[model samples]
Target: MANIPLEDIQNDVDTIVSEWIDLGLLKRGELFVIGCSTSEVAGERIGTSGNKQIAKELFTSFRKLEEKTGVSLAFQCCEHLNRALVVSEDVLERFRLTEVSAIPVPGAGGSMAAYAFQQMQDAVLVESIQAHAGMDIGDTFIGMHLKPVVVPIRLRQKNIGAAHVTFARTRPKLIGGERAVYSKDQAKSMLCD
Candidate 1:
């Protein structure tokens, strides 16, 4: 396997995250889910070669993102943990999320999650969450954890290291039928009886 410099991983994360932030989708106090596969990021098959070093780099970048945006971070574990999330205790309590029991290791939870579980203060595993926005690294399938009405966000930095990255932000589902007005202008034109 080719060695991937840790700095490369950090740079990719920084660039991708910066692009996402510029999109104006993430908000303060919102939950942001991250699903990553370190093996894939290192140009290997997912789950084949998990690397803690890579996870460390990613965690560092994510921490900066959280500090800058005020968005809470949630790391999704691999299928071995049923894709449960590692989140700060504050977020679990603030959001009233269901707590789960598990200690993530590199082999089971995937590197990114394990690193997050270790580094985050008062980190706890949660059964699930409805994140306001999320980024999927290496096709970890974080859709289930995102809120309803997910909208795909396209970013210039497509891949983080060797991993293909996808981003999304949620919106409230638009209800009502065709007669319902959506925008302020449309509502203004309508006269109530």
Candidate 2:
């Protein structure tokens, strides 16, 4: 957008992440995935135009989230790279994810992912991951990186710039019949069953 305010975009990110923290959907020592399309944010077709300014705004917000929550962030690349992700080596080691070799540029990986890769400490390309929660900016389709049992979240700030936003968090899959009770009190019984 010609008049896109970086603060507003950053605020949108802050609000969604705050909601996740408030709901306990995201916690410390977890992974958060982000899929952003800077072109869509600028009111252009996806992948046609990548904006580093927009990416910088979004990435800064994500960094704030990480600093506050102690959660790791992963950036998902565009389809040119088959939507592979960039994450810190610590996250790779923790999750046992396989590392791939490739340097992301704006054309291939999209602006946001490429910017994130540059910003991350010990960044590495990974084939896949099972994140605990995530945000999809501009319909970038981040769901593929989230853990199974994703529950969609509706946030107050539904869009960042012109891009549609989607938020989600994962939970442990429920695997029992009608007779099964699911609660903290039943945790031991379920685990011992």
Candidate 3:
């Protein structure tokens, strides 16, 4: 069981989300990935324990954030499922992600992923995704899900409960060298062509 109270978890998640938004890491309609270990949050070794209550609290917080930000979430499952993600059908369709067949259970997928799989409407399992921004709680290694050119986004809350957390946001690959301009100037040049 998680020693951390639900309120504390909520507050931590809220702060992380707000900081990411302030840092310009998150935006509306972006795909955000979360890889969590309820066991780690509970102060136990990773994969040794699973806490549904903790998972629920985190999921609720994420739902509130999504409601306010319009950002979609992808919950990464544990290694038993090869770290596949639990995502909504809408996200799957929009990203053209390949769907796999595997219903996540607490032991196999970790509590967070299991909770997400159950709560999401029209949810599906995806083998991989290229998310715009991501948070890895408990060192679940969410890096694989993030897009190329990932930029680490530091947050005020370094850890959520006993779990260590890391965040990152993706950016477009810079194509040109020192003299080349990006963004507005590049767009103007393209228009001129």
lDDT of 1 at 4: 74
lDDT of 2 by residue, 96-189 (tens): 9999989789999999989988887699999999999998988989888989999988878788888898889889999899977778769777
* RMSD to truth, every model: 1.7, 2.7, 2.5
lDDT (tens digit, per residue) of candidate 3 on 53-76: 889989988887687778899999
Each model's TM-score? 0.94, 0.91, 0.91
Q: Which ten residues in a row have the lowest lDDT in candidate 1?
A: 184-193
Task: Give lDDT: candidate 1, residue 43.
Answer: 93
Instruction: Order the numbered candidates by lDDT, best leading.
Output: 1, 3, 2
Number of the top lDDT candidate: 1
Q: How far is 127's C-alpha from truth in model 3 (Å)? A: 0.8
Residue-wise lDDT of candidate 1 within 1-193, one digit each (tens)?
A: 4577888889999998787777777789999999999999999999999998889888888888888788999999999999999998999999999999999998889888998998887999999999999999999999999999999998888988899999999999999998777787767767542
> Residue 105 lDDT in model 3?
95
List of clashing residue pairs for candidate 2: none
Candidate 2 vs candidate 3: the lDDT winner is 3
TM-score of 2: 0.91
Q: Candidate 1 at 85: error in angstroms?
A: 0.4
Give the alpha-carbon lDDT of every model.
0.91, 0.87, 0.89
Cα deviation in Å at residue 187, candidate 2?
Answer: 6.8
